[model samples]
Target: MSYRIRPAEQGDNEAILTLLQGTPQQGAVTLNFERQPDYFRGARVACEQPDVWVAEARDAPGKVGAVYNVGWRHVWVNGEVRPIRYAHDLRIAPECRNGMILHRLFRHLRKQLAEGEWMQTTVLQDNQASLATVASGRAGLPTYYPAGTIETSMLYTRQRMPRLPADIAIRQSGSADLPDIAALLKAQGQHKQFFPYWDVNRVHGDEYCYGLNASSFLLLRIGGELKGVLGFWDQKPIKQTRVLGYTRGMGMMRHLYNTHSVLRGGMRLPAPGGVLSYLSLHSVIVSNDDPELLRLLLDYAVAFFHGRYDALICGFFQQDRLAKVAERYRRRLLLSEHFLVSYDGDPRGTLDMNRPWYVEVARL
Candidate 1:
């Protein structure tokens, strides 16, 4: 089949949505990550600077066979705030999964990529097909260097608050608190690689913070000094995770799981075709990278959002000790292998891996 790979145009939105809907991610609980109403809205929220592309079949005029996005943002890399790319949301029509189309798309991407540029992408550990292809060393394809594993958890919100010092306060922030939040994030984020380096403008104006503002953040303060911050972004209006179906074992246990969930005040298993109701935990920053501070912030967030959201979704690299905080809560875990990709070979060797990774799960 003759194919053309080009920058995505506004008119291709519907076809792209069709491709996403038809390609439900395969797992015990199959899910369709959907962008309804407007796909670009969700894409913009993923990255302030986004370059989206689509693969079109010459014979099938308006049909989109594949789609990919390169999301660029400023993040703390090696103790400096630098622009880095995150490659995600790659989807291909089931019938067009042959190696030719993928290779052609990669060839186009390779031609467009800047010299020595490297980007990060993640794939579920269970996705052997994609892992195999990335490791195939196919011509014109970028090299995928294994970085680390990221553990995303849907931590349940129905939990008791942790006891804290009497001087400490956790409350919803106001407009006047924006600058403090930004300062706190910047001051502490440098200790973690890939932590976002954003200011008040990005917080207020960027699509990445769509449907959110100062009031959306839960700020932790000790004796009038800012200590921590966590923001909740509700992306349901633009993007949704719809349950397509489940494996026979999961299907059989669905009812039992839901019953247990209700009894424990946890998130219930939604029926097939039902959308997941949750919030993406973002802008996480705790003073001095202290685990206790993170625990205070997360616990406060859990209490603040309880009964309002099904879960609070967050991720941490396997080596990050902060991940232990989420693990203590009732939750579901999803693990993905992170990789660094470059046309140049093995970029990981030159990079410093001392700092723990901190990819924003909300953007991924």
Candidate 2:
């Protein structure tokens, strides 16, 4: 049962992917968040210089028992843009999930982080096992301070796009729009904690914006002035969410729902083992955080992404007023508990509660 933790190399991709496939997030509809083709592709895009770690069985060489990653990027915190780490993709094989393995992994992780370095992570609210583990106060583990809830919605494009006002315009962005896009994102994003600091000029070459380009962004303009921008990213080429299985009752319920959806124009639930086709809505910024502007952008996005994706996914902290906009759509909601982890001190008290919290769902 001995294990050794080390920085993962290119050779560990298959082992890491295997571990991820075996560990599906349990819920009504179980899902396996998999990195296909290569695991590192998705990891590289998470942030700049992503550091991935893997736990291997000493008795069985090359057999990965667990995997984790720390992705560093500049984000707004307490009204300042600074480097922050996002800890994600912490997966352990079912056979090695005993407390000992997790503690060992954290011990090594703790050694790598600086004294006051704080990181953020999210656990699905329904993941009771994970929630309990984080709250367990295990030795050598960082303290996870409760932040808030992230409400992620899978909005179905079931309705037709609404008409826009004569002065309002929605169009795909061009290369010349980078400056204005950057300006709009920064202006609106500053009001939210953890919103990414965009390098719009380099987005096409940035790993964090992998599979995205200027044309992927949809701009909402009023009287020829940019008011909002939403970027659509399709990560399917690198990362994929496959339907693992549904709970007993959920399986039957999904069958009925799919029947009706197929008859209508709604998005039908994917069959088990099938990959979901969806686009993630990123860089979601609007002037004044206006719900009406967001609605207009989403309406145009629906038309822009129609026939190409089954659904569009986005997330907003429950405290965010704009979260109400998604509630009006035909959608399925998933909630995750956000946390700030630190070994030095708690970050919760220092944060301003008035600001909206934003975590790009695509990166997670």
Candidate 3:
């Protein structure tokens, strides 16, 4: 099967979008074929930055058989910030599922990659096709090391006006909180690739982590000492296009589950993937050995966005101690699993499975 592999062009948008709505094996959504917003959107234009590749059928002229994209981010690893690339939207038309078309498509993209740069990608833990494809050595894809799995949890919070003790302080943040917030994020984000550094002025400026204003951020302290921070990220444009079909089974069981939440005065949870609008728990940084602070901080987050969002989405590495603690609070666990694949050996020599990671929805 002869095909043409080249950088994606503006004219390929429609074809790419159509291809994205593929069979369960390759579609972005697990169980449905709903159209997602141009994941690349404005960034696909040449001047804006073209990050996609298209595999066109040589016999059929302009027909696109497959499409793939690369997402890049600057991350702190080991001890310094470095650029890392991640793979996304790797899809092949249903008719081309046989043969070596998938490998051929990935091969083209691999050859064009820069030398010495580490590439990263995440996949749903249950997506057998993607998991097998990445693990298959004969697939003509780059070699990837399975660092570890990360999970996203849908945490719920409610509105509560209570008297606070003199030692406990939870409030909206101000400019004064930036430095500690930045340091805390870095402290928690160490050892993970693509963990963005916080700027004193633009605290969460990285593309995958974008919390800049104080109003969208919350801080917690004890006796004038900063203990924890959380930020609400409004994924506005992408929200409308998210497909809840990814977790249909959980969506069905949501009513029974939310009954207890409503009884407890909490908002009903969005059926998994049912969130069309949400607030991501960004900059989830907390002090060492402070599970109580974590609970207090999360309580504030839940109360802060109550009634304003369909759901509250939070991501954390599997080993995070807070995972165990949070599970005890509300076991809305098993949201989704993600694997961070690092192609080629890590340059920083800091790629250990037990290290701290900044797991969030944007990276997924």
lDDT of each: 0.86, 0.87, 0.61
Give TM-scores for every candidate, taking all chains together and pairing residue i with residue i: 0.96, 0.95, 0.77
* Colliding pairs, model 3: 157-302, 244-273
Model 2: residues with Cα > 4 Å off, grouped in runs: 246-256, 263-265
**223-246, model 1: which lDDT tens digit per residue?**
999999888888899899999899
lDDT of 3 at 57: 88
Clashes of 1: 0
Worst 10 residues of 1 by lDDT: 200-209
Per-prediction backbone clash count: 0, 0, 2
Q: Once model 3 is optimally superposed onto the true structure by TM-score, how far is the C-alpha of residue 249 displaced, in angstroms? A: 9.7
Judging by TM-score, tell me the better candidate of 1 and 2: 1
RMSD of each: 1.6, 1.7, 4.8
